[model samples]
Target: MIDSFETDEDIVVVTEFVDKQLYALINSEGPMPEELVRQITCDLVSALFYLHSNRVLHRDLKPQNILIDALGKAKLCDFGFARHMGRGTMLLTSIKGTPLYMAPELIKESPYDHNADLWSLGCIVYELLVGVPPFKTSNFASQDCISFLQGLLQKDPRERLTWPDLIYHPFLKGDVLVQQDLAASLPPLTEPLSDSQQLFKETQRQILLDRQPRGSKLTKFVDYFKQKISLEEGNVKTVDGEPMQISPSTTPTPDNPANSNSQRVHTSKSREKKKSKSFEPKSQTEESESDEENQVQNYEWLDYLHRSMEEVFNHDLSCVFKPPLVKVATSPLLKRNFSPQVYNSVACLLILPFITEDRNSTRLKTLLESYAESNVVDLLVQGMWTLLAKKKSELDEFDLVKSKQLSSERLLAIENIILLLSYLVYKQPYPKVDIFLNQFCNAVKSRGSSFALVTRHLLTLSKRRPKIVSDILSIYNHIIRILPSQSLVVLEAVIGNSATKAKEKKQIDLGKFLDSPNAMLRLNTCVLIRYLTRKFGASPYKYWDDSIKQKLVRNAKEDTDLKANVAAGLAVEVIKKLELITSA
Candidate 1:
């Protein structure tokens, strides 16, 4: 689509005009044929691979950002949210994107990578196939495309489809040779090959080379769990009508599992075990080699399971219920693997919060302990919690007025932290419930407007996830059970929040509840004011409007409920105590 470039004024690069946006095309053209959608998905993903390989991330990926020419060819446009993200660099914390197309990792405010684009790709594919994004529409039906769609929509990016997996999957591989041939023929046309198309063909060529057997192959992995792989050991399979090196012995008879009997190859340790029952002492070198082999096998097995989660079982809600799935989320030992750890740890935390049953909780806890040997739990908690603290501090320094107009990264970060904390408090409280709450309250103290926005965020969450919020709210309300001891910590936070809001002079719509007719509203409002007095003592007299202060004081003093009266009286005592201390 590139026409020419003008770098003189603002480096404006011109491109051929595309008559329509992808969103409009989908709406006007009805649902596309599944096969056609598959080809589109391939081209789009191939484009993404090129962009990602070049160290760029198209942060905002939605149907609106995609353009369709009269020939129905798609071009990814809009680089406003695009940024160059080098290898091992921190995940883009400066979030900017449409919400519906965002990956769950981004939604949870976890550090994410290029695979985030795959998640959005999944959304686009779903929209094309169903005329709406997955789960958003009841109009779509489940058919041949469901499995391919599920993998891309996976919440865990580590478990989501990667470039290699996308190219090899059945959907894109419907006629593998044909698709590759089509991909290859693009370069010869009068049109200059797009960066995306060229890069995609290049990837396919590299993949084809890698897939070729070298000198009859030395090692054959037993894909024991998922034998549906097209490749088979020692099997003679026709590849586009040409015989391959694979022999009849290694051919898979997956459809006839009962009749499929073959010699099971044993791993080194198993092979060693077959030799003798007696324990034989070995040299240190032998022991180290055995250990190394076992480690390699373990990692390979984990990788296989990661693929199986996406390919075989499919990433459904049921995946979250499986206890053993924690291994996918557990952080690796090496520090350089922190990005995966952050993603996995966040997944684990999100999973834990939703487990309400005792049996499920115990099952999940045991699985987590088994996977990471219980070492990473506290570390994971501390790491994510710390990132959240840092995000809040960053939000504090950014201009609130301008920041408000941008994406809500800070809002998502805080809500995720609170929900994770709430879950931790409910599920695994290694930091101790009271201690963790204190840390959270303290985190909120310096957060400035971030704290003020939390009330609004929670209100929004309450609407969207009422059942989940109801449960989370109970854990939060439990802080009141420890009242006057560490209970005032939350109250202090509320004071800080109200103070920040007052200073900003921005009125949240929800904040209007004070003057509402609802008794519950009036009671909660009065309760907040009572706590404000306790924090300020007599200082509210100076800082607050006289009319407002008097109204709050009178409400607390004259409220009919005895509980309300007592809360109101505490403010007076705080004032008297401050006066006595001053007189001394």
Candidate 2:
């Protein structure tokens, strides 16, 4: 598929068009020519070889599932039943695939591997060559054809032709030329929407909304325009049974059309007074006038709403358009027994099929209303926190050798949920202090390693969404009292800030911070050393030598900033105590 996107009413998948299915070609021309069949068989075998070599099984491999282009090139389609046999996966017990093309082992509900697909390929090949499957009639055109059919149609899977031998079999040996892998030829399935593309998509959606039928509820501005025009023409009661409110000075006549919108703001303020007074059981004529006033106000409000929405949608969308670095074909929602409970939660599962983040909440809110059982606020915040914690854990446990592309995909998925959560939290009406965040902090305090992971993840996220920097600092500040050593990674940024003009290195030298001219940097460095002293005692001296300790002692006595002197003095005291203990 080229791209897939979800609308309020439908989910659309875009793909390249093919001429016809193999089933259609076979039905139209009784039996294909041997040469044509040879070309197609080569294509099928080449496709199967690539799949089986990669440990994938196209469980459903019939003629109807194959597509042919005008160039007579055959392509595999409909991987709805595809399965990947990962490392150590010996057999798949699920009974899948169409009955007619099922292997003998699959038919008997036995365990099978990628070889099951080979049996289905044999059935399709016989049908393509003879215009009917071999099992339907025993009659054979030639001895060689019979021999080829018998090798594949064996009752026992052990006797069936394996993928390696089938490709080199006499029927398709010379035909198996090196063919290009389908995936390598196609563009990426999904790409990040550039600024221009985001604007274009917004304009396209608005145009679609405008083209909807006038009376249909889908057309947001159409019916309102009709009502507004009718109200000005006939001086009738509005849609809500109120008489039209037209101020004499601002009213538009055929000759005075220019004055209509000039004093709209003045008229609205006057109408508000009239509306407030009308709330106290006014006469029928007065009530009608008030309702008509509300209709005009509603129309004006909608006009403003559309204008504001246009400004928001057309603004720089790059900050929000975070496409996954690694895209997976299927959503995690469809898979069972997946890790990181965040992916399986109600909020994450709901938005997995759509874009990472959307500013407009109409669709998301509609989905929440439909799919979410409990409170939307609770569901979203809880899921976001769970994902944040898992993200930290994944980063902390990174192993270059063991981490596959799925690990990258998992991080992207977690970020996708986070991006959506940020938008939702900013837009939705929820309490300022979320209970979920409090619970997360409490969990981190209980597990010191979790504090390291959480703080590291938040620090990484703050770089992307700068608005979350305060939250990161808040969590780091509060949690440090309970776990000091765990906050070492986050404090490294404090030391790194002092070395802005210097060449970057993998590890920042903490000693450099003590010699910096900036008093705040020197102060934070003292605090960091104090934390290290509290955590590792005199052990830090082994790595830094006595120069770092001398700098701290000098800062305690001669630093310009008094706070730095006090912090450095405290750090020195801790180091002295650690030194005495070590000597003893």
Candidate 3:
């Protein structure tokens, strides 16, 4: 198949247009052409040999997935379930593929290798040569085909003919060059879509919402229809007797003569207020004019921080496009096991625009209502804390990520949930003194967040739980640059100030902060290390074995961020001078 760069406009795969499928040719056209079958089988074997030699397995190998081009050449298509096995990897356990063409090992749910594809090829080849396939379920006696079928249709995968063996078959070894053009043999294909036609369809899709909203509702329901009926899943479809609605991302352009109001929904009547060129937010009470304000009323005000938060002199904090509206549902959604695709759609609409750390939330309640459902907060508080509190018997976060026991897809689901909770708790300050806040702080010390919703909250952990301390330090390092103001609070709490005891035991180790997949964390931790060194000096480094000290020093110097490198230079200089020890 042909390929293209990763742009948004990929509709269908661009491949060599084949006139007909091998299955259609066999069924519709009168009789099998032995010579043509030989050529097709060679092509099929060639594709499989390339795949198996590279330790790949095409789980599905039915005749319908094979296409015959007008050039009389065959090609394989539809590798939706293909997998790449590592060197010395013995078998795959996931049960998938068409049962009719499935190998004996697959049907028995036994672990099998790439040789499974060869068994399916035996079934197809037998059916192609003789009118019927020789199987336990159905068979027709054929003298010539029996030996070839016997060579491949093995109950044990170990006994199945490998690709190297199959290619040397007597049927394929014979030089039968009898003429048969597949294009002439099969019926003509339907006309292809013109460029103009393809463009028109895409334009229509992009310019308007789908014609049927219920169609999407049905699609959502169909995803879990079995559970919807049996388990009776609950869906939040309406608010105050009105249906949930999704809004168009962009409004109609100035050249369009039709009323913009008529063309699409405004989502909120407050949206009709004249937008400022500087994007200054309208007053919180501006929603008084909105008809639906009484039902879904929300108060919104801009809270700006200087853009100096980035580099201490970047610029002024800029605009708010409109009052942020947390889109609940324009259409219904399956709440259970939500996929990343649906999560991204929500992020684009409600979260991403306002994610800048420079903005502040005055009220956590108002923020949650504007962005997510009421239950999500409860789900966030309960579901996430449970995962965070999981005692690492032997597994760390990286171990969870690279788990061989669970599918990669399942690992993503767990991480997504944890990340969702982090977004929920984002921007809300960690209370310096509160019972409920203490509970949360303890969780942060255990396993805070694995996602990028940087929290402004700084936890002052006095308890000596090693896991919690490690995770809290990770969060502090991750978000130090994102929220420099709060980061200082963290440093003060952990590293101490001038009035503090000079010989306090180091509460948290900065070395565990390394090896984070988040590159920003590495740079930020190095900055914190520089700050810590100015307070504690070279004493910490001197006590450590050479490798630990070398690693800490190398990290600061080798950091990619220019600002971090500068910080490292200052840190290394202070440590070398042993100023704290000399002065004391």
RMSD of 2: 26.1
lDDT of 2: 0.49
For this target, which candidate reaches the highest TM-score against the unseen true structure? Answer: 3
User: Which residue pairs in candidate 1 collide?
Assistant: 234-247, 235-246, 235-247, 236-246, 236-247
lDDT of 1 by residue, 389-428 (tens): 3222333323222222212322333334444444434333
Candidate number with greatest lDDT = 2
Better of 1 and 2 by TM-score: 1
lDDT of 3 by residue, 163-280 (tens): 4556566766743222223444221111122577446534433322221111222222222221221112111111132321212223322132222112211223453363313122
Ranking by lDDT: 2, 1, 3
What candidate 1 gets wrong by more than 4 Å, as runs, is 1-76, 79-396, 399-417, 423-477, 485-488, 497-584
Off by over 4 Å in 2: 1-14, 136-138, 178-584
Where does model 3 exceed 4 Å of error? Answer: 8-13, 30-33, 130-144, 174-408, 415-584
Per-model TM values vs. the true structure = 0.34, 0.33, 0.36
TM-score of 1: 0.34
